[model samples]
Target: MSVKGVTPIENTLEINWQGDQKSIYHNIWLRDNCHCSECYYPITKQRLLNSATIDINIKPKSVNVKEGKVEIVWDTDHSSTYDVDWLRIHSYNPRLIPLDKKLKDDDDVLKQKLWQVKDIKDDLPQVDYNKIMQSSDETDNEEAIKEWLLQIHKFGFSLINNVPISPTDTEKLCEKLNYIRPTHYGGFWDFTADLSKNDTAYTNFDISNHTDGTYWSNSPGLQLFHLLYHDGKGGTTSLVDSFKCAEILKAKYPESYEIFCKIPVPAHSAGEPKVCIQPDIPQPIFKLDHQGKLIQVRWNQSDRSTMDYWENPEDVIKFYKAIKNWVEIITSPENELWYQMKPGQCLIFDNWRIFHSRSEFTGQRRLCGAYFERDDFISRLKLLTLGREAVLDSI
Candidate 1:
């Protein structure tokens, strides 16, 4: 076992096993487990075998060390190799438990952080809705529109009632709101359009419990729907707070929370301009903010790809079952608030924070809607807050 040039560095340990020399750095054991697709399968939820799986019968054909890498040719028939970093980690720690354990623990911490709500009220400033609306007829009204936008930001959404009802007036209202956040997507839906038409843009049919733009890489944050004509039929809209749903999950199934936080489930759209492919981001179905306030829940059963990264298979199944149970609880009659928008009334809502659905209608129900970016709402809120401070100083 006399290996040539066998020299161990001051802080490193060198080992020569059957002509193969491996240098072990002091911190090699704590190296981050590379989150590569080959290393971790997002769908199978299994970690590939580490260096302990190396064949003992194989003898190194050649061993070379350069830079920070140890290159070796294992037996002519092996036909493959290993990286120095990988070898160092594998050799130093035969049991690959810490990386995965740390990931799971970090997930727990993130879940805790997400469930706690951040106090944003102190950071928000007040604005005058009437002043802002009046300015809409005057100057460009950038200042006024910014103030109205702040109200929407503070309330998550707002209802503008008492506006005169007319198809032409509805179009003007949308145009005015457009100044707040230019509608990335805009359309009008009525009874005439086949309610049965299964399209994302216009859905006249009775919708299910779902969020809009789950397929988008960054879904539209806000949605404004104006009721131009309501025949007073059975088309009432229902809303449920997603944060409330998260709270129910945290209280009901703690183990399921642990599993979801560890697993990385694929959520993507199969259409053109592929939306998002986020990795094991370690998010729970329900998360609380820093102040122990419920924040949001990432729920969409239809978009769930696979739950292979979960170390515990049984736990993964339990987590999904818990999600279904939570959905049932939130959508129950008691939890949902139903409101029918009258003609000339507008409803704006945070698409991310609230889940909305409409009941099947009997008569013609016409409505116009537009979407806005989340960041745009934040920007308008900030500007309005600053402007309000300036006005207060002038007083």
Candidate 2:
């Protein structure tokens, strides 16, 4: 879109954008976002302008529309060039809807492809280890690694076959891309079913499908579970796409979904000294971004603490009913996808979307795993690919 006209005011700049729509931008905002060489470094694509040093009352000395751009000479003697297309995308006039809001309102923004057992049973995002882990050439390896990460971003989970049967393999794998998320449990951890630890994950009991670290405000994003050895009778990993189940709730039972979206549930670690557990963290089961898109799911029955928050008795009852229905839907037969993780196989899944559990087993079953922070994973994806657009395009 091209700029039709430009007008400089005392504190704001008004642009007559394409379609005869007017967009107003603050003078300070435009100055901070200047694309000039002095204000921004194009090589690193980073802004050099310091907001703290900027004059809050700065205004444009002269503004003119030329060659499809708004040329501005600031009162501070700094000249900047802004493409009309950039202004169109960054418009904040109340009369004109924001570009992102317009896209989302139009249902043009893509969402993750939620799947159940039957939908992706035969077509799981399974990749051969050699393509991602053992490519000889640097260019080939980068491409393969990008493909592997893309699979996780698109499907929320991926299986890499033929991984080395070592606990350190998970660590090495993290280093290949970025760093493994280090939390209270450390950067990398290995565990086996035993009563020595208080956590249910330590015992050979039928662990319910749950996401990890609901106790933390920012839960872990991606989880890496690599079975090093399993001489066990059973321990099949059960996965449920919580997002998929949530979509069902939203479509079929809108009231229950609304309750889940509104209410916050308490999750706790119960102060276990082993992992330095901190308790009583509150989180909503279904989280939505500011744009009203389902961004994450946090549900762990065992980790959930009592909801003692003061509320009307009727509302409390409604919460209980909604949670009960939510549990039933998530645990439904058709939603679960079970797989027996064998040695030399690593299952990388989006912890925010996939709820995982372990079936009770006998004998020894050892697993090594690690967590990757949500922002880190997203940053890596964007650096390697198209960031949010990559996900939108994939869906």
Candidate 3:
């Protein structure tokens, strides 16, 4: 973390660490990140100096390692000091390929531990409700909440044991991040397996494993479902880590994987008598970030709209084949994990990464659940898990 030396390049600053390791920081990046009280506000974690005002070609008059800090005197007569640890964490080496750019921000995405059914069958991440909600100390509660949420970030889903079997308790859990996201289904909602709506979810038939809200451009990021009551048999909840399935596809069927990643498929939900819901534009089944790392999985075969928008029948066939390949991976025994939710058990999952399903049942199954917006949940996680400086940098 201690800087051994600093060398000012033409448009960058190179730092040699205590060991043989070295890193390069762009001149503009350094200037924009000058975290001094004059240039940045600690409380808001916002830059007081506008980035657009900084010259693109600005150079440093002198760069030195002083008192374990990188001190830079810019040609503009402004000076900035950077802690070596922050500089090291924010270093860039200009990787060209998408795969090589995966670690650009040392965020949760980089630390994800992808897994299949075997990894979670017995040891599914679960937390005690009392620990998170009834802790006497605020720090203890914060740590408990972080533990409850970090599970979803790392493995895509988690279970809360002994959550009060009340509809409002589910809303309370959702509020741990911020607030429940409202959909066509009401906010802070509860539903029973009755002919309440037009969707098949109102029936007793088995539901396939799929991520919800594929029809929306910006789908809900997190989903919580608590089984408030299940008087009859079956209705075991099933979950699959689509991220893990995707990795297998990348290794086994690269061509098909690429098709899923590139081809946009339209989806819709016209079950409601008065309203029709669909994304503004079609979206790829396998969504990836610029780094070529998978971010979300949109897989709802039943919600897929007709292919009239796609003119090429050959392309349509290829898309079907790609989808079939992905389906095979997710349906495999080793990929699916099933659990029977009791009245007091609540499940929270990252909708972007996990596919959830339900088994056929005879009796009425009452459920209460809510959705958490993607950015809110992620920011909450970062606030709980990452250092203030790192969180501020991301902001």
- Residues 29-114 of candidate 1 have per-residue lDDT tens digits of 21123234645454654556374554433444554655544544434433223344344334542322222221222333112211
Angstrom error at residue 32, model 1? 28
Which is the better candidate, 1 or 3, if ranked by lDDT? 3
Residue-level lDDT for 98 in candidate 1: 27
Clashing pairs in 3: none
How well does candidate 1 match the true structure in TM-score terms? 0.53
By lDDT, the best candidate is 3
Can you rank all candidates by lDDT, best first?
3, 2, 1
Tens-place lDDT per residue, model 2, 1-395, is 66777777668888876687888899988888887888887667677878788899998888888887788898888998887756765576744554444233334222356799899999989887766766433554477777777788777999988887887766687666567888766688888876445678877889988999888788899999888877769889888988889989889888889888888888777546655443445767889988798889988888887788845566787788887888888788899899988998889999999999888899998878889888888766654654454333222
User: Relative to the true structure, how large is the alpha-carbon lDDT of every model?
Assistant: 0.52, 0.78, 0.82
- Rank candidates by TM-score, best first: 3, 2, 1
- Error at 212, model 1, angstroms: 1.3
> How displaced is residue 242 in candidate 1, in Å?
1.5
The stretch of ten residues in a row with the least summed lDDT in candidate 1 is: 109-118
After aligning candidate 1 to the native by TM-score, how far in Å is the CA of 163 from where it should be?
3.0
Give candidate 2 misplaced runs (Cα > 4 Å): 19-22, 35-58, 94-111, 135-141, 274-276, 279-281, 387-395
Taking the tens digit of each residue's C-alpha lDDT, what string does model 3 give over 233-270?
99988889999999999999898998888788889989
- TM-score per candidate, in order? 0.53, 0.86, 0.87
